[model samples]
Target chain A: MIRFEGITKRYDQQTVISDISFEIEKGELVVIIGSSGCGKTTLLKIVNRLIRPTSGRVYINGADTAAQDEIELRRNIGYVIQQTGLFPHMTVRENIEIIPRLKRVNRADVEARSVELMRMVGLDPAQFLDRYPSQLSGGQQQRVGVARAFACDPEVILMDEPFSALDPLTRVQLQDELADLQARVRKTIVFVTHDMDEAVKIADRICLIHEGGVVQYDTVEAVMKYPANEFVADFIGRNRIWSSPAFIRARDIMIQTPVCASADTTVMRCIERMRTRKVDSLLITGENMRMLGIISAREMQTCEDRGVPVSRVMRRQFEKVSPDENIVEVLQIVNRGGLSAVPVLDEAGTVVGLITRSSLLTTLSRPYLDETEAATS
Target chain B: MNLFTFLVQSAGEIATRLFQHLQLTLLSIFIATALGVPLGVLISYRRRMKKPVMGVANVVQAIPSIALLGFLIPILGIGEKPAVFMVVVYSLLPIIKNTVTGLSGINAETLEAAKGIGMTRIQVLTKVKLPLALPVIMAGVRISAVTSVGLVTLAAFIGANGLGYLIYSGIRTLNDYQILAGAVPACLLALLMDFLFSLVEKMVTPACFKQN
Candidate 1:
């Protein structure tokens, strides 16, 4: 267990992290989320003895970290940073072998352990072992960072926004991979991220830090369901509206059976399908049932040749949003991009449904209108 | 001028003279590195001594090589002692500066990571800090070496042998080729030392730092 007892870090007269106290249980993934300069990183550094607290004690396992040799204390903890901090010159194998080498482990053991760590982090040893850090992508670099942290086989790992540098898709993928690695390895991890969604997604216990001290530290379900104060409520930000659409799948949002037309179908026939269904557009599918285009009412009037194939007259370019995307994200995309409509695509890139501007507007406006109506009533 | 006969007569004398100078310069550099590296490490380890120790090195550097050699001649007398002493003094700045810079410049995170893994102070210094600092220290050694080669040539005035003898002999005889022979080899020696140490620096440096 790692315990922070009355940890108060001050620079001159101003206090950065004040009287922060918490105990992280063994093998638990505790995530700390806060805005920049909230002292989350400072707190992690203090725990690892990188920075000493002005007044407090960090107890690792049972011994006070401050009293012990700082260097020796640090060797017992694994640290991962947002930049990944992989030594640029060293190969993946060499980077992983650093700690082991420092420990004066046998050469054979270091090599074997390096291979094991590479495998554990999901990088094939034979392929990536000799490759330098610069050659790896951001996500791959982070994985190497994780591998390096675990190189010494320390029981506690401190991750400071390790995945923040990655793209959203890659971030989520890595998060899941990390979760799996954590479960398998069962190392006690203190993960720091400003992104609350990531904390909720991966944290065994989410510690919400505001103004240096932890405002709330609890299970994800509790934090999401019952925030401690207005600050937490605001920080968590009306996650209901943000998270509501995540429950939705592409099939649910999509037109179950779209008014589809073949490439050979005349533009007039496609228009007839739109008219019959009272839909604004009819999807154009190819021989392989791939979504080729959408024949809309606008296209019918614009096309000079009404008898032309629907594929020829239909608008091929359109915006798209995944149904699983948060309503907040969808609204942002619609408003920011000035998109009139977006096609919701499935995993196969097949157009499942159309998300129009009106639908998004309605979705966004519904809560405010309902609140206003309730207040009036 | 009978330059051919002059060259033939001077060749054997110059070769033996050059060998002696080269040997002295090389020996002095080897001793300086052996002593300077440890002093640098000691200075780096102790925060209080850093400024003072570096200040001493700076003072040594400020003393002109020729002046220092002349000053040392009074104490040690004209011979290898004064020459070697002067070379050692001249070489200290680069070796000491590089050692301190190289050791200090090691990534704080990497060091922290080393300590986090429970490495003792000696372990960190030997396993992490020393290896990481190798390239920077080698760079310093290279500088010291080249400087020593050039400075050692001045030692001929103090009765130390080597290429400096050619320049000294040329001055007495008014022989230009003798001067050229000494001057060219000395320049070449400096260049060669720099080139060799550069290769050593590259080899010792972790591949990550090479690009930058």
Candidate 2:
């Protein structure tokens, strides 16, 4: 874990970072984001002791970084930059093995580790190991850069817009790969970038900064749903969440008070409740709000017996989602199953909310409508 | 006698003077590289020293080769010492200038990455900065090497034995053949120095810098 205690930095008279404080838990991938000149990079450099904070202490796992030897401290943390700073003169294998060689690791182990890293980053070690950095494409070079960072198995990895220099297609590919790699390795990673979409795509928690001060440091969902202020809302943009559909969970956009009926409720009563609530479906529940099944208005319209309980008429084997399931999966289930309404169930099988086709449509189009409202108002 | 007959007859003396001229040139170049490269690296880190050190080099370079020999003769009497000293002083400018340029001209991003990766200051200089700057520094050495060949002929003025002795003695006697013998060989030696250093330059250039 890394904690920044009231960190503030000044250059002569101008303040770059002002009294910022936050703690990143171990194995968490936190992305620090801000506009250009907002000191996001400075904040990252301080953790590695490349830029010393004017005041305040940075503690890495209960040890004050200010007291540690800067070189030794840096060796224990991996760093990757936007420019992909692989030594041009060194071959890819040599570049990846630098830190290990510096630490005087066994030569054979370092070589084997480098080959494994190359394969981990999705580069073919046999073909790429002997090639100079100049021979590799930009994306490939950054891949080697990433492999080099992981060469020593450092506890913390600091990535300063590592993928920002790549083209859009390569950037997305690397982002997905990095997210996958982070999941498997679970390193404490602190990534800094100005792009909100990139932050939302991979960050476990997004640290939003403005004017050298943190505006909000929260999970991706919270930051998207409840932006701290006008600056954050604008910076995050109205439609930013839509770009990363995975952050949009069923609980976030589902209708909270879905028209629900007891399993023993008569089919006629269920139809009546659906009509009054202006919903096309009724979520049939058992004791303690346990979701049993769902009955659509079409099923009610074709019912032969008006007095039959909803349990007999309701469809049990229907698509359902957990509250935490992302909207993308929800959309896929809805699209594949031809679901009119999908009940969101929490633990204990209780129906917490309902995501209807209409609700999904409104949530998808909210950003454009908000934009239109803003322009006219 | 014609220049060709005079040259053939005095082949033995020509060969002896030529050997002395080669020694004088190589020794001065060696001394200059030893002193100049470190000075250049020093000034690259110590910004305050760059202007004064470069100023001294420029002033020495501007001095006529004969005047430099004349100045050195007072401190270290005539012969190989003053001759080599004159050539060494004259060659310092290119060597020092190129070293400073090469070291400073490395990409800033590359150096930042080097430091960011936890290399010590010395490691950064030796591993990243110097290797990248080798070609430029070698270019400086090439310039000095070629110039040293011509400069060493001036050593003959301080009574250091060399091809210059042949030319200077021939000048006093107005012997065209003797002057041709000395002048022709010195010109060829300058070209030879340039060719030799160019080969070293190619060999030392890193693979990444090579086109194919």
Candidate 1 lDDT, tens digit per residue, B1-212? Answer: 57677667778876787688779878998999998899999999898988988898899899877888888877999988989988997788889889999899877766765565556788778867898899889989999998888888889888988888888888889878888878887888889888998998889987666665
Model 2 reproduces what portion of true contacts?
A: 0.71
TM-score of each: 0.73, 0.92
Tens-digit per-residue lDDT, A18-129, candidate 1: 9999999999999988999999989988888777899999898888887887666666688888543666656888778877776688999889888898888888999999
- Complex DockQ per candidate: 0.23, 0.69
* Candidate 2, superposed: residue stretches over 4 Å from native: A260-287, A291-320, A331-342
- Record all residue pairs in model 2 with backbone atoms less than 3 Å apart, i.e. clashing: none
Over the full model, what C-alpha lDDT does candidate 1 score relative to the true structure? 0.81
Stretches > 4 Å off in candidate 1: A60-73, A104-110, A244-377, B43-50, B210-212
